[model samples]
Target chain A: MSSPAEYAPTARTVPTRSRERAAYDAETVHAILDDGYLCHLGFVADGLPVVLPTLYARVGGTLYLHGSTGSRPLRTASDGGLPVCVTATRVDGLVLARSGMHHSINYRSVVAHGTAHRVHDPEERRLALDALVDAVVPGRSADCRPADAKESAQTAVLRLDLAEVSAKVRTGGVNDEPEDADLPHWAGVVPVTTSVGEPVPDPGLAPGTPLPDYLRRFVGA
Target chain B: MSSPAEYAPTARTVPTRSRERAAYDAETVHAILDDGYLCHLGFVADGLPVVLPTLYARVGGTLYLHGSTGSRPLRTASDGGLPVCVTATRVDGLVLARSGMHHSINYRSVVAHGTAHRVHDPEERRLALDALVDAVVPGRSADCRPADAKESAQTAVLRLDLAEVSAKVRTGGVNDEPEDADLPHWAGVVPVTTSVGEPVPDPGLAPGTPLPDYLRRFVGA
Candidate 1:
């Protein structure tokens, strides 16, 4: 399989701490972003920092965020491109070190800095919304009905080009110092994973509506 | 059990979209925050929005963020209080709808807007660091070695008061339209849960050091 191209790090995308954990490869960045279903969208609101959790989908080199037409961030972006920072993180494990100072979490995260603009084109908005659905469940877009004209008009899709992005990852066992190796404290990694539980059918679902194959085999980050 | 006090809504914390999902009760906000181990910390840097995922712990009305003394954000906060927005989110399920527009995720999220100041008091810093370790695994602090003077000196802790906070939650099945109920599409909620897997021992762990009970019964968000 062909790998994604690497992204060159700009001054802004370069992390200041733990430079070894920072990855500029597109493959690494996309993998972390794709595996995550939610992103924290950051923007300046009234000159104050504001971060909001929202559903997101990645298509090609762009990230699409779902929001209501009346959402403040979407409206602000529609007026003019809104400078935004989007972050997605997955905690893989808890690193229990011998000392409190060395304790950390094993995680994979991507941070993207760019301007988000509202997607207004009818066809593009439709495709973006469909990608979002499929992002959550592969092949879900094809199984579901397409949005009608009014529904499309009511939803707001913000697109942010993945021009400045970087991924940070921490893995492996605890990093306790050799001096404390024999401290009798258990030092290791407790793996953490997101699992998909049984699907709960809607109360009004038609009888005998079997669970789809896609969801039956679904796995989350 | 005593319930957590509610925080009054300010114009900033009020969500423009999904007003019904916004919760002002401190219990809801604290529960969401406590259940999450990672948070996306947002701030403005050089007139651009930046969001970074980091480890954090909540103690009563304060959220303590783990950082290094050399970290940029910590250094900036040490100079003066840094305006920050911290957000924690836990995805509960994927809501599949008959139409793409109605697809959403069931999640619990909290957003706190405040200033984070560098924690300077040594005693409080030690307690905060211990709380952080215990936050990951209950009773972990007592099981592990405490940080030495030099280690504590090198670690930076930032504290943000849990003021101007609000929790937003979306639960239940997909809210598909009545007209699309019989569309022959799969519509339901696929529950998502974070599970703690088998603990992995460090390769150099001392022989006969048994896994701690706290880790054996760990349950992550």
Candidate 2:
């Protein structure tokens, strides 16, 4: 018998035994979520599973997802809460190879398993929307106009509690087999990274308008 | 009552009635999967959930996943098949904001729900590995040295059948609310994209080795 917490509604997808490397604690989960601005949300739709890549923000222990009211998924949740799985991941490096089979990638990722409820409370939705903006670019919210009643009415916000979530990571140099390690093959992390280049100002911007300093302060991936 | 096909072992993440925009057909799923080189895989581990971003290749209806044999999840799967969820996403543009909350990203993504079985059959594993390499760089695999027995032993390959899957997408210009549309805020897609810069040749390569056409044929994202 499975514990109540482990009682998967549909059992086949749940693992029976835990793998040491696959497990992660709360702190690690929070760290990955904090660093990522976008998340891939997985959910069952109709009889099929769908993934949506969208902007999100972490507030306290929950993730807030926002989208247009015209979007089917968001509208469905607006009328009532729904279950959603969200995963946030970042690629840290590329594993180069001596052989095709040995090639791999280095990455860090977080998965949240829970239900997401529509944020019916107008105030909470407003704050969550702000958080979403800030998550993409710091100090960006203040520079832009606030959402008015009609605009807010046209959007939908859903909150997924990250009560049961985990983070997993794999990094470092390529793990070439010992025998092949001695072979003269170039094997190491190629170091794939994402960096914000100098911001391109809008063509119509006033000549004196300066880019925000926060945009320059990038976090190490 | 649901159709037998819909009797999947996962809960509906979005309201069944509102999944129209969130659900995609098989062709859309394969298209999204085929176009991307990396993916975000999510799975439950140790009562928690996690996501890992890694490189992948889609072959027919199966996805070939590569990682070190020592990787926790891969290792566990090598010893025994494990249930896992995988997703691949591509970003097409960034929605810039007049306000932070309105800023968003436009993307396409595919999610799969299935168990991953380690490839024990050497020949099949080799093909899977080759497909992965070829997926990254079309002609590079043949140019690279083949993996020997020892090297193959240290690498892990898992195949996930793309049975339960769907792709969702959002694209086009920013949909600013009417009131905010008139606000003195610059709102439009920044049109972010990924493209291959000129390939820097390896310093130690033979002086006469011409860059392959495959490497030069990269189209913008």
Q: Find the candidate with the highest lDDT and give its number.
A: 1
Report the C-alpha lDDT of model 2 over B1-221, residue by residue, as the tens digit.
01123323234334242355455455667778887678866555453444555568888778888777766678768666767778787776667655554566667777777778888899988888788887765655665668778878877788888776666677766655555554555455544444443343333334555545554453221
Scored against the true structure, residue A129 in model 2 reaches a CA lDDT of 84
The stretch of ten residues in a row with the least summed lDDT in candidate 2 chain A is A1-10
- Given candidate 1, what's the lDDT at residue A2? 29
Tell me the DockQ of each model, to 2 decimals. 0.82, 0.18
Clashing pairs in 1: none
* Cα lDDT tens digits for candidate 1, B5-50: 9988999888887889999998888889888778899988877788
Candidate 1, residue B33: the lDDT equals 84
User: Model 2: runs farther than 4 Å from truth?
Assistant: A1-26, A70-81, A97-101, A200-208, A213-221, B1-35, B41-54, B59-86, B99-102, B108-124, B137-140, B143-221
Task: Name the top TM-score candidate.
Answer: 1
